[model samples]
Target: MRKPQVHWDDVEIGGELAGFDIEIKPRRVFLQISGSQDWYPVHHDPAFARKGGHEDIFMNTGFTQAALVRMITDWMGDGGFLRKLYFEMRRQQRPGDTMACRGKVTDRYRKDGEGWVEVDVWAENEREGVTSPGRAWVILPMRESS
Candidate 1:
């Protein structure tokens, strides 16, 4: 199916949007797990992760959440700006797994003569289920008349 190209006027109170899939690799995981210099074995050591009850080293929650935002921005395009974004982690995302990021428009309105859209968003991992789910608000440029 063709992807959605949502104009400011095309958004509604309950419009839904499909998410795209992304695969998590070790290198990506390294980029995501950034906080401290602590060499926590679980984060980078597969052996330690296994001992900690995880199958292997996993990506950081913050990184996965950020991916959700990137997904939304890519979907909305450069003409859209993110106003608000929030998410909660539901599961762990191990390497080699693919996950989907999705969103649905729950509200839309005009403020200060600009168009805004609110969306319910989520990220689902094949190995760990819905890794994150949350809401976002974006302001898109007004569409021009044909």
Candidate 2:
């Protein structure tokens, strides 16, 4: 589905992007593991996770990265193209935890005639202050050029 377009001229540096909250469930964790072909038992088996010293089954880094990317693109809409995404996994996200994904536009500029915005993004849980911290570069289409 095409999302509402966010024009380059309308963006603001230091502006907060739309954020989302999600409750991580065991089913969702399993789905992510199956979809991503991540067959590691730590992602889907709580017993295995406990053996590894974690409280329970936790999300994989690859899945977490994909979710962060979704958070950015979903807010930027269809007109925004993700140029780069980098993140560090600070903490493990477990089932029954609510994760808040948020972002802020840090910088905006024109590069090679294309408008770009650099965003600082993160996912925080009630227990873990920050689970994943990352940055992304997105290209937003200009209204005049579109």
Q: Per-model C-alpha lDDT, please?
A: 0.76, 0.87
TM-score of each: 0.74, 0.90
Model 1, 15-126: lDDT tens digits are 6775788787877666665643445667678998999888788666656666777778876876789988888876777789886888888888889888888899988876
In candidate 2, position 84 carries an lDDT of 94
Judged by whole-model lDDT over C-alpha atoms, candidate 2 comes out at 0.87
**Quick one: best TM-score, which candidate?**
2
Q: Please write out the lDDT profile of model 2 over residues 1-146, one tens digit for every residue.
A: 66679888889989998888878986788778776889889889889989999888888887888789878888788878999999998897888888888999999989999999999999989998899999999999997744
User: Number of backbone collisions per candidate, in order?
Assistant: 0, 0
TM-score of 1: 0.74
